[model samples]
Target chain A: MEKKDGCVKPSKGVIQTEETKSAAEPVQNGKETQKMLAKVGKPAPDFELSAFFEGGFKNVRLSDHKGKWIVVCFYPGDFTFV
Target chain B: MGVEVVAISTDSRFSHKIWQEEELSKMVDGGVPFPLLSDAGGRVGTVYGVYDEDAGVDIRGRFIIDPDFNIRAMEVLTPEVGRNVSELIRQVKAFQHVVETGEVTPSGWQPGKPTLTPGPDLAGKVWKEWKPEMAFD
Candidate 1:
């Protein structure tokens, strides 16, 4: 079982839901997901996050690609589920 | 015609770098065509609804955004399921075609395939507009 701690190593492509959705509310748990994002057919939420660049790190933002098509994918983690 | 592919995760940039160097070398022939954004604190993932609080990781999610920053298409998959890159490419191409030509592709549409224009007269005869060919796999 992968603990909810950020320090623990992740296994490849292993998926586990939360023990209780109640615990994740306000507290946030990785098991239960809330499908409430107002994204489809609307504007995407603009976000700026760090990214692995050419042998370095760079901040990437959603608004940066305003003039181009953007394919945004969110995977689990490195060396884990890709 | 221009598309920017950005991947994100809760992992730190250092972890992403190491993973790219060690594991992705074999999988990616030349290199990663796009930048892998690091959502280190899971803020972006939470907004995108792909964040899992239990495992402290993100589920597989794909969003196709157009040039005007509009969300054209999005898919959220379970952690166990892998995404189809070929299908994504096809969808991107489809979106591009529609934007350029104002025509919509039918089911199983691929490049060079016939498309449908939305109209009442062309509605019932959609079968006549598109002919199936054994081109796309």
Candidate 2:
């Protein structure tokens, strides 16, 4: 079932357990996997981080975008995938 | 596309700089129009709850913030999957339309399409008027 915010719970078959960890392996679906969290309509947690922008090294703070829409996307690592 | 897209990764600034200069620059030269932010310390990822503490990195997490800075949408994918950039853009456009017109878009709703007016019976109203092609059910 999907939550009010459009997130669907993984089917029972998709949930992995510790017992399955060692003896079993995730079936490859020939698709890329992603990890995500945060419910829509909820307050986004604030944070301060360093960024390499065109200008120079700078502190990027979530609160800094107070009046603007921010698309914060997290990738597993940099330069690994394009 | 006036929306700002920021990509965060746990890689260090030096590595980020090298990648941007060596690789990302090619995309910028080829018309990639957004900025990539380096989350060297993983602080941003941690706060966003996408952090993989054991791996010392973040999982795929996408958040759409409104003009007022409230989170309007959030999607977390498993680490092996990547996000759909086009869908993100579409969602931004749909959100912009809703913010401007005060109308709500149904599932898979796109621009220039009919949007439902909000009321006490919003879900049912939306469902009743929803096109079968647009809905999962």
Q: Best candidate per TM-score, number?
A: 1
Residues forming the 10-long window of minimal summed lDDT in candidate 2 chain B: B30-39
Of the true interface contacts, each candidate retains a share of 0.83, 0.68
lDDT of 2 at A4: 38
List residue ranges in candidate 2 displaced over 4 A: A1-38, B30-33, B120-128
Worst 10 residues of 1 chain A by lDDT: A12-21
Local accuracy by lDDT, each model: 0.75, 0.67
True contacts kept of 1: 0.83
Residue lDDT tens for model 1, A1-82: 5244344323222111342223234534645443335367777777677667777666666777898999999898778754
Where does candidate 1 clash, by residue pair?
Answer: A18-A31, A29-B53, A29-B54, A30-B52, A30-B53, A30-B54
Best-fitting candidate, scored by lDDT? 1
How do the residues B1-137 of candidate 1 rate in per-residue lDDT, one tens digit apiece? 57898988887777888888888866996458788777755666776788888888878999999988789999899878889999999999999999999998888888887778998999689667765553344
TM-scores, all models, native as reference: 0.78, 0.72
Model 2 lDDT at residue B20: 77
Give candidate 1 regions above 4 Å deviation.
A1-38, B130-137
